[model samples]
Target: MTAPFPPSRPSPTTLIGGHVLVAGGLATGGLKYAADIEAEVVQVFVTNPRGWALTDGKPSEDTALRESPLPVFIHTPYLVNVGSPNAEVLEKSLGSIRHALRRGVEVGALGVVVHTGSSVTQSREDALRQIHDHLLPVLDEIPDDGPDLLLEPMAGQANMLCATVQDLGPYLETLEFHPRANVCLDTCHAFAAGHDLAAPGGVKAMMDALHAIAPGRLKLLHANDSKDPCGSGRDRHENIGAGLIGAAAFGELLGHPAAAGIPLCIETPGKVEGHRNDILLLKRLRDELA
Candidate 1:
């Protein structure tokens, strides 16, 4: 088989990389896998992904990451749902984010990723209000140099606050456009949410919409090909270039003017080898696409 990557190193300025949640410890596993892929940017979970635990057990690992030149991002536990109407769940969600932000700071993360969670019981307005009520205090507490709180839009599931990129405007407005609030655009989720990344000029169109909503606030990119067709509303993540969205769509995405400096992290389904290949593929495309 041909090598996926040539000997050339990827540019750290673009910060394109992957989500490395390996079998062993997060602190070591994430960095090792990233190095293997020549990834400049990496996303990792500080604690268990499925649970509400906010503790980081490896201080040495965190210190290593904090001291490293690689920029790190932390994905909050899936259980964090600040939009929940349930008071207990709301409290837990707020606590989870609060803790995650602090951990991000300690680990020298550029940002902490949180999903734009669903609103089950209340109307969208009420849900936004609840989020505002709970999150404002948390934002108030964040130090100026703390990592940004990046909101990742979901696959347009029912009652999701930020179902589309445009939907982020209201949330940011509610937060009074706090400087620390930024965005993470997920390609698969964007496709599933009815943004046509596969169509011609679609990537540019999406960038235009995002720029209109919050100018220059897109801090992270979750680069993944979608498993299902567009508008499927599913969150399945396929590897780069192997899914319905295809390779050309990502080429267009990389070449777009608005995507110039944003960090691209592949959240595609993969082990270390798979991700390394994917990263190499993206790097090759980035060169040719540019």
Candidate 2:
């Protein structure tokens, strides 16, 4: 029998989880993977993350996830770039997102994460316009009960349309501040984008900035450590506590008021064992504060 689902809204306490690769499928392998890691929440890709091929979930797997006690989330394929200048790339990106959203609803996901894309070969203004024109209709079509569209800002890579927490202001305004358009702050990305999460009171300061810029829109957090230095613009992720963003900073992150009810999912390295250790550390940090 499937387990009961978690609460629809944010919980009073934070939930910790990792991105589970369901190579054996959600019901058969994914659920077991989550259990192995002792995850309180879960994130999965509904299709090939690096490819444009759209695949459907198994009915059994869908039902199992829909009823699972853990709150579920979907990370749209990496190929999705709604801000692309090329028409074909743009079309495929939108199609991939729509598919992810539909599958997210099928699996009772609470949020769907998509990267804030870059403005390749075009001015940032033109790219934002493209995103506004094409992506708004897609956002409008989401059902009331469907998962939220969580826009994760990128590391401050060259030409990225959205990198820092402040960049979200313009992006959301371009979307006319749609109710479904929410934020998913990634620690590694934020640090790489120059948030200085490793410094004293850095996490709290970043959280304060986020709340000021986009109040009540932070629905998810990607707790990751950077393999590169601050402001490096690199996206390489290292295992928790082993990289630049140190374990202490994560404790601060857990204690931040703005992060109290948010669910944090690690996208760090070291598969199952690494994820298990990371989750345990985060839980310990959270418990100590509690």
Candidate 3:
């Protein structure tokens, strides 16, 4: 189906991708899936996404990923909530991030992306303090060659720390403006947070805000179409051109300077076939709009 909004003037510089599942119980299944969809970049979980357990990747799997030409990214497990109040959960969250960083190195990943989790039961102030106290040491220990720690802003569900572009300030400050810190802006999350990416000049305005916050820190884009409307605060993701944000918004995003030369991975529904089609659809929008 054609997108509801006007097709954006596209650019040939963007490299779109998908959140490929590690199919067939193979850690390299994500790479295979990316290849199947002709994706230039790929994102995957180095271990079970829902659990805290960190997998010791096999030599063969590590070797295969290193040999691949794709720009791979490792997403820290969902169980990580670095802002959690509970001591145990907080410790695990910190450990999980460190583990993801180490794993990213082993797999030759470009970055390790983690959500800016909510500050449940704590004020934003307190959460920022905790994040600083715990994560500062970890960031200090990062080698000069370690993959960047990219923060993915979430939909402004209650207590979300980095809901808008301006909200990233405290986190950046807390990291003492660490050079390795970067952003992974998600279209659906920004739309859900009421950024209006589908509206005229909306993408530019959003980029302006991000530029004001931290120039050149937008290292990745989660190119999702929100199933929910602007300001709905829902995290539902829909396929390309098939949701509230529409395909044109994605094209708009691709056209923005902030998105050039980075991986735009769709975290939409469906696996292999769905992701394959979505990748093709994005590429079509990019080329046709250009």
Candidate 4:
């Protein structure tokens, strides 16, 4: 549209001028159509949502999946309750994450996105320790072929581990700072978590915090618009511009210095209109910023 985004100001660390990868592939055709549109990246769920479970698949697609020219990512199963207080649930959670990561690797995906989840019980410190204990060893076992672990922070509520960008530091620190582990900040969730990403300097503030906490581990952005107001802890995602955060903030985000080179995965609702409209809006804003 704008003659290939002329190299101008310090372009955002994010992969600039590119459309966000639509959120789901397994349950929707949007993923398939998106690929044909020349999208450079994509994010998808390899299993059932809302829990730590997986959907069955054919063996042949594994090679083609991994080899696809698109830079790909995997959304972990929702059922995998990493913070569950019950030992049985904890076991299931570990298995779920492991299986999900393995599936992502087999499919040739680059990363597996996990919620900066919280405790099913009220034990905050215990949950954090359990998380470090449960996750660290499993991470070490990941082969070179395994997909990267991209921890997406949740809204600050109750016993959440990654409410703020800085909170992830301790957990990550406990792990000895593995190279393949990183973060994916969701725009809506950040707002819901009480970070005003819409205000001037907010985006950069979060970026600075992320850098200070995780250093080079910031890898992706879940560019979602929130339905609820800032600080609400709700999980509703609205269409890009129509939402409370407003679409223009995406410009702030994409224009920020820290977003460089990472994919912005859109977890918005509505189909192609949902993603395409946001993509169009983002490109326009990006051009304006450019």
Best by lDDT: 2
| Cα misplacement distance, residue 130 of candidate 2 (Å) | 0.6
Ranking by TM-score: 2, 3, 1, 4
Per-model TM-score on C-alpha atoms: 0.93, 0.95, 0.93, 0.87
Which residue segments of model 4 deviate by more than 4 Å? Answer: 1-31, 36-38
RMSD of each: 6.2, 5.6, 5.0, 5.3
Better lDDT candidate (3, 4): 3
| Tens-digit lDDT string for candidate 3 (185-251) | 9888999998998788888889778877788788888988888999899889999889988888877
Candidate models: Cα lDDT each: 0.83, 0.90, 0.83, 0.71
| Order by lDDT, highest first | 2, 1, 3, 4
- Please give the clash total of every predicted structure, in order: 0, 0, 1, 12
lDDT of 4 by residue, 1-290 (tens): 11222344434323321233334433234346555443456776676666655566446556655666667787776666677788887797777778778888777777888876778665778787777788888888778888888888888778787777777877677566777778888888899988887787777788777766776677778888889998898878987888888876887777665665667767778755656676666656656765
Model 1 spans with C-alpha error above 4 angstroms:
1-13
Clashing pairs in 2: none
